[model samples]
Target: MASKQQTVASFVETAPPGELSNVVADIKALAPSEAQALAPAYKKYNEEQYITVKLPDGNGTAILSPYNSLDNNRYFDTATETSFEVDHASQKTSNPQPHALETPHADLLRNLHKALTTTSSEHFPTSSHTITPTNTDPSTLTILLVATKFSPQNFWNARWRSTYTYNPSTTTLAGSVKVDVHYYEDGNVRMNTRKEFASREVSGGAEAVGREIAKLENKFQEDLNRGFGVLGEGCFKSLRRQLPVTRQRMEWEKFQGYRLGQDIGGGRAK
Candidate 1:
């Protein structure tokens, strides 16, 4: 009779002899090529003590570690992987069967990705732009944007990130777009808003829908740029200052002098 197996609390914990033996057996069962493919992941997990295992399918990527709650007691990662494919427009053809209504939104995503990434503006260069299709009923798409000042000397390190979720309009129904924005400088601020567009806006074709959505995104980004500047100069300036009114670092040793005569020695010196 075979000995019973043991389970560790999480992947971070060392596998017991029984579990280790079983893992070894699983590895051995794979074909030679497949076993060879596992070498890199094994080495990475062994050395770094953590690893994110990307699914072979393009749908998403997974993190296999204790941090992920789904894998707390199992060797396999059960948590859903939510990922966006950067510039997914070019790879859209890979989908065997796409919904009839997705084409216009695909165009919108592609246009947004192109316009943002191809700009030469030094103010905020495009860092990343990605799109993920949310296959829920009344299909929708999510677009993520990241723009940053790419200079090493720029201490402020200004960054603008936004997420836009688009709901396509049917023949009789108007559609809506929801946007969430995060702008970072000395401090960060966030804004969320939604807008509805008439069905006529997207009625022309894919190109029309793409153009309309791109226009809305550009306007929203510009508004946030102005808003963030105002906030940094007015409200956030004091919080970011390095020195007090003396224009120098506080002298902790001298601070005790003020407390020499008070209870807890916090008053002026006698």
Candidate 2:
């Protein structure tokens, strides 16, 4: 069995673009030999997540989660379980039906912008005054709006519920554990930060607003894990030290209506 530390080191060493291809080639080279026993496990692990360097020559890198087999069932299965049906009579019914398509967060932000700008009875005149989306450039403004929606404050306020229904036996190691442990140990925090920055820039800065939410979420997860491990030892004490600065950045972004300079202590967000 591979040591967790060794697995993490291997991932980190191969995570970079110029190096990752070489690493994959090495893995391929190993398939007929030492790593043959683990080939099935490796194939499944590769399917879960992979790194993509957008501009391999430049600094651009992205962690891609392309079309996993696991994600499709989540959306489709719910409708089947509910037994909801739509017929011609119901389609022609004169009552207003809520939008059937499940909207993505990005789409919701766009709708929020449209609602803020367009005049209607549902939207208050004062609300329009509070948010001026017209004068601002749509590309830049949309990003800013999205960022505000997902700010750390808003994310924490939203109701959150999650449960892990399946747990592997403690006695034996499993393939799933290998994949998860690989990610947790080998994933690049800096790459994640860059991806967050680029995504915000692409989405009209909404991607940037996600960083704060990400920070809070990371802290929350850390605290939860620590709470489970040792009594009275909150994991966020060192992490919280940086919150004041992030709060300042959030405020600056809110008021100035632009992204702050990306010098968050050498881009570590700590």
lDDT of 2 by residue, 40-95 (tens): 33333332323221222233222111221122211111111111111111111121
Highest TM-score model number: 1
Q: Quantify all predictions' global Cα lDDT against the true fold.
A: 0.40, 0.27
State the weakest 10-residue window (summed lDDT) of model 1.
Answer: 86-95
lDDT of 1: 0.40
TM-score of 1: 0.34
> Clashes in candidate 1: how many?
4
Alpha-carbon runs more than 4 Å astray in model 2? 1-44, 52-54, 67-212, 231-270
Clashing pairs in 2: 143-204, 143-205, 200-207, 200-208
Looking at candidate 2, the ten consecutive residues that score lowest on lDDT are: 172-181
How does residue 204 of candidate 1 score in lDDT?
A: 52
lDDT over C-alpha atoms for residue 145 of model 2:
15
264: Cα error in model 1, Å: 22
